[model samples]
Target: MSTANERARMTDLALQEWGVVVGILAERGESWPDTDVTRWGPGVTAAMERTRALCAACSIVGATEAADIGRLADLYEARTRS
Candidate 1:
């Protein structure tokens, strides 16, 4: 049984992995990109649920501290430019 801290860590890791995967996909600029839900729907959904469940365990308090979101936005811009 994972404790709240353990679950939060797992969720963080999962989010990081997803970010990396999305970054790679964005870099490739695929013509027919599959939706994230379709590709890893179950896992993504699970991770999100876990993250929400462990929301209190999250270290970051607000949007201002969300560097990952900024990174994702940059990736989106790069994809559009290419």
Candidate 2:
């Protein structure tokens, strides 16, 4: 668990790491438009729907947890590795 301020900080860290992912993709002469998935078949779209449902239970529109921010950082790392 994390305080709101801590979650905000982690979000910033995750975003900065994602910027590195973008740089790595740019070096390979690829961009988002070139590698877009037609649509998330099931795994991602279903997860997104579930996440939205959980978020709806929160009183805040954009409430977030530290673990969620950490997950974003993990996704950024995976993107750079792939």
Candidate 3:
């Protein structure tokens, strides 16, 4: 039920957080741990699902782009978390 602007802000925040995590992972040259699947997986999955729904409802191309950015963030979160 978020407005477009709110969704955009959320997407930006997610991307920023993901970028930091990815940078750390790259520097470590190590994959993330998989044992804690229950912790990160559900959150990432929910984020992606929300992002996809937001993309579908987006009225502006920019909003769609923001959603795409959010998707990338979710991808990074999933990859780095496991």
Ten contiguous residues with the weakest lDDT in model 3: 30-39
Per-model TM-score, in order, reads 0.38, 0.40, 0.40
Superposed Cα deviation of residue 38, candidate 2 (Å):
18
Model 2 residue pairs with clashes:
none
The digit string of per-residue lDDT tens for model 1 on 1-82 reads 4465654454455345545545555554521235454555454456544534333333343222222434333544455479
Clashing residue pairs, candidate 1?
A: none
Error of 3 at 5 (Å): 0.6
**Native-to-model Cα distance after best TM-score fit, residue 27 in candidate 3, in Å:** 0.6
Tens digit of lDDT per residue, candidate 3, span 24-77? 544546334422334444445465455445455442434444445445555556
Summarize candidate 2's per-residue lDDT along 1-82 as a digit string, tens digits: 5467654655555445445444544665654335444543454345444443433332142334313424554555576589
Candidates 1 and 2: which is better by lDDT?
Answer: 2
Residues forming the 10-long window of minimal summed lDDT in candidate 2:
57-66
